[model samples]
Target: MERKLFLKNGLAALGLAAIAPLANACKKDTSGSDTTDTSGTTTTGGNSSTTCTVSPTETEGPFPTKTPGSLVRSNIVGDRTGVAFTIKIYIKNKNSSCAALSGALVDIWHCDKDGYYSEYGGTSMQTVDYTSNHFLRGRQVTDSNGLVTFTSIFPGWYTSRATHIHVHVYNSSGTSLLVTQIAFPEGSSSAVTLVNTTGSSYGYTKGMSGYTYNASDNVFSDDTAALETAVVSGSLSGGYTLTHTINVSA
Candidate 1:
């Protein structure tokens, strides 16, 4: 686990889609407003917030079978070794124009600072450290507008590609209708350098450009300059923000 030497060596290579509208309701208030007068005083009131209500919609597959998972590593909660960062995935069901999708599940999983996966019930990438169970994974449902958010740390950098997160969007019926992964821009030198510094020490491979970002992954057929990057915020101690939107309904 040496420092400078780890960056100079080490290399490894390998590797490897929506819904419908429910219902819409429109209420027209043609009647005039009612006013009350008392002692030369008048008062009027109405609904302050607009509400969108829809009828029951059909359920689909591949959704979570049990409770949701967690993406943040519990052990590294306060670790300020420059290896910590936050990842926030924004979820929305654009297909539901009539009403916002509520209770729509979103499951996300990624590697840890050491490039390891929890595997849930299986094993891949690295061994399944029981302690890491559900450490870097989580499941959340969209709110009234089909929106959900998860607070996790930035993923570690592996060989041959930029930092990315694997996302799964499922309906209430546990059917996984959409499977996709989003990546950050390869231009963040500071973020890339941090990955290289932390991962290199473990004898892991280094990024071709000394940083991690998109624009290099062959899997992202739609990988464009704009789509490759995401918005990240946070401090080196707590973590950073990772925000990106994917247009799946289109």
Candidate 2:
């Protein structure tokens, strides 16, 4: 009898642990009062550590999606070429005790594989003259489950900035809540090193010679790397998938 009880309890505990990360994705407090998700807290990078802290607010420039409201599609890969990357961003309401923030608007934009951004170029910032071109940028609204996904290409690095993706979140009323950027890990097995090192023939010609790392990046250098870093998976051949939960005070 004692052995059977132990097995049943262990299985139930495993089930709850699996749902912990999605549970802390966050929700909205319609009544204007503090609410908490009884689901659980976040599990960072497959670790046992759990917390529901608000995502750090960062700038959305050097470049931003010029007309994000008009680009409402899930797939933002418009003629760009490089390794495939899928972005899954979970928005949680810090004010609501880290419940999933349903129905929020999210805008994400990043540079192409060769260190180029569409819509604006040829000036001092971008010398490529892609002002008439638009790619690698799009917008999406969170589902009732507080999640938004985007189809894009694996981004390349540029001067002064490490590999990153810019994000802008808004309330249902279209009010801007936070502007931030997603950072990636740098290791032998990470895309940051592989995409630039062994991806030259694959069109990632920029290489990692003078690449900027997170430790030297201006925005994430202030110890915000841990808070903004995303958990990226997959490989050079099969493409990559990135998952990061952003908590907001909405």
Candidate 3:
């Protein structure tokens, strides 16, 4: 799609929720450091020769924020409730030896604590009608460090897929570069398990009984998860902070 068209459109309409045929309800990390495939990261001077691997693009389907440009802020929690979540994304330029890609447009959106999305809803995949709502969605421009952070709630799970976040990166010129998703950590000690386990207070109703694991997710099942997952830290009571690195060839 054209860059101008994408920005001008804003979240005016909601994409159809992918249900039934959805490969995975949801078929859907690491920490400070980038994936092993990337040689290294830039230093404080921002002049180091960091060669990051080009991350594979993923589908932006089911639901993508219609007008991301309209919602530009660090705190995207709009009337939604759940465990506080902080998302940090670092975008690097693989084509330019992995230098920090400053001024890049980084937009992210995810489901609420109850497996519902804003703007468009009421589909088989999503029963609630949130067509007029706009939560858990925002856009920001990467700073000198090629980083943009967003404040939201720890996303809840749906069927067929694992808990994940959708990210669309655009160049400084607003040209779409990569559209990918960030998977969360699993296991008993991981935040994903803790948040889902406690539903009464947090509003996370589904729990983990029928939850989908990353291994069986249709999107990340292709083995690209190594680079797609984020390194999450913190707690169920204290909230969680996620840091992920996205490498783009542009």
Candidate 4:
């Protein structure tokens, strides 16, 4: 009889132990009910990253990337040949109508008189000693009055794009707020021929197509005519005068 009583008591103890684990599991579920899904998975907390989008007009103008070089280069006609030409860029916050934008940064790059651009990887652009950094390209910061100047050559015309300089403006924060290519007006036949010959040597497929206007450029369709002026005064042996005004919208 004692043996039977011991067996019955052991059975009851085993059953109670199993019941205890079940009760604990139920308690845990109830405590976290608010966080668990029907599939028993815990809900995610707010720990993910997100991206912010901003429109172009809301940003300010660019800050200077480099100090203005004190080198007083010439803006003369004689500088366009094997020599490098210099240009003074005027930065403005507003267009010709007079809007005020301060602290604009201007970045400029142009091809050399030989129709070669720096970083294009060719011997024709520079001299054998590589001293001719002929493609005059540089950046400047607009003062409180909005002006930046650079020393560059009279860019020879390319097949599709005419003789032009590319300018990119950004706000202080490095945001690209504006992009425009400045172009030169059509000159005498000799000037046109020079551009065509140099451009052909550089593998340009198309010849100059009657100096396209601002309305014709695919990228700068909305740019103002006054902003796209071409200043040409003379040749590398002589000198030339070309002035362009860029008007930016507020």
Candidate 5:
């Protein structure tokens, strides 16, 4: 099946639910070694040390620009405001024994503190107008280590979806490879809660209350544990840094 079609059907198979608190508490430990299973699927995190498997394919949401080449850069925060955040992603090719894939274009975009995307006008829930705004949207080419980093603010929560970021990876020649979203773990380990609740001017309007958890999001329900990013917080006054390794086919 086509990638987009597969993700659409996958979303349908996992029925959507009303926004609610997560039932399972997120674990604090986010470190683990990689090891390959008998099925050739590499698993990361938790107690297991296994070979890394291909990152799960996900839907390219409606908001992605029809032409994504124009938005290439290291910094994506155009003119937004919120707690400072740094995101680092490592790109590896599972088809080549989990080798690092350099020079790959990694595109990332997310909602602002008020849960509104850039370059698109405000939605019914978001009242601010941003028809020409382009915050939180940019692309970075992976370095020799297959690493791409972005400096921005921690994303805010919306109605049905959990706190997340959308990512799309393309080869040097611009062939789309992977389309996926990174989810923040729920509960005390949640970077979303730490930044929003304690700070007086962090700019996260919703905080954690009334927000959908990773366990409740249809797109992540299938494997919330595997997809959750490892988050490290400095101080509410400072900001947070998130890191995740993305494995994909060459």
Candidate 6:
């Protein structure tokens, strides 16, 4: 895990100066109010902190398409019902002083509330047909501020794995830059717990039962803290928001 640096003509250095305007534009809120967390920290979206450490790369798992264009779009929820969840990812180039990487393709996919993935079926635990169902899978291109958003349901857990979301970043030409995963904080938050237990009427079925936590997940055990996302906000009934910054070597 040696830190890699970017040269003057490297990908990170390209269009580095154009990100500020994009970031500012994305922050323009009609309500003129910042998003406040339970800790009273107000932030624009969810990237208020300044940590430039590169996110550890993780396996893309066995589900992602080997090539692009399988199912590319911004909103991936696709008729699946569960706790409403929105994920915001900020992409930065660590080699370029963590400059925001504009126009990068951010791809994300995860299992539905019942621990079944879309576009694939007949796995050991997943007997339902999903070859035509593309829920919980989508891609968004980074804006000028290096931000991409995905509208998805709260990911459900399957056997031998923790609650997590898979992310892949690529340049505009589809050159893969980073492959990693974002994990939820161990133990359900006040918002998540309610959805798991009493939100069954709202399409929640995981309920944190027989679930594997981050500490035990092999891919995340090396450094779970770094891979975990900030505590989620809002309730399952009203939808939730989770955000994290991803630093990658360009």
- Per-model TM-score versus the true fold: 0.54, 0.80, 0.80, 0.48, 0.78, 0.76
Candidate 1, residues 1-250, lDDT tens digits: the string is: 1011111012222321000111121121222132423442212221211222211111111112234444322232232133455554444444554344566567766655544445332223223343324555667666665555665555764433345666677677767556555555332234443344444543333333333223333333232324424555443444455655433331
Local accuracy by lDDT, each model: 0.41, 0.71, 0.72, 0.39, 0.66, 0.64
Query: Of the pair 4 and 6, which is ahead by lDDT?
Result: 6
User: Model 6 Cα displacement at 46 (Å)?
Assistant: 10
Q: On residues 1-250, what C-alpha lDDT tens digit does candidate 3 reach at each position?
A: 0001111113332333332233323322222232211222211111111337887688785679998889999999999999988888999998888888999999999988777788876655457788898899999999999999999999986655678899999997889999988887666556776677764588876567656677766666677777777778766666778888889977
Better of 3 and 4 by lDDT: 3
Q: Least lDDT summed over 10 consecutive residues: which range in candidate 6?
A: 19-28
lDDT of 5 by residue, 1-250 (tens): 0011123334532333332333343322223233434553223322111357877777766467545688887787788888888888888888888888999999999988776777665443234567677789888999998999999887876655767788899999989898888876444434555655654476664555656555555576675446445444444555666777888887
Off by over 4 Å in 6: 1-49, 188-190
- Give the count of colliding residue pairs in each prediction: 16, 10, 18, 21, 9, 0
Kindly provide the TM-score of model 5 when superposed on the true structure, using C-alpha atoms. 0.78
Candidate number that wins on lDDT, 1 or 3: 3
Top candidate on lDDT is 3
lDDT of 4 by residue, 1-250 (tens): 0001111112321111110111112111011012323542222111110111111111111111132243223332223344234555554444434433467666666655444454333232232232333335455667666666555444653222335566667776657666655644442223333334343433332334333333343322333322354444334333233444444543
Off by over 4 Å in 3: 1-51
Residue-pair clash count for candidate 2: 10
lDDT string, candidate 6, 1-250, tens digits? 0112222122341111211112112111121123446763323322222677777777776567444466678788888888778888889988889999998988888887776777776543345677777778888888989999888887766655656788898888888898888766543234434566667887765565544455555565564444444446666547778788888877
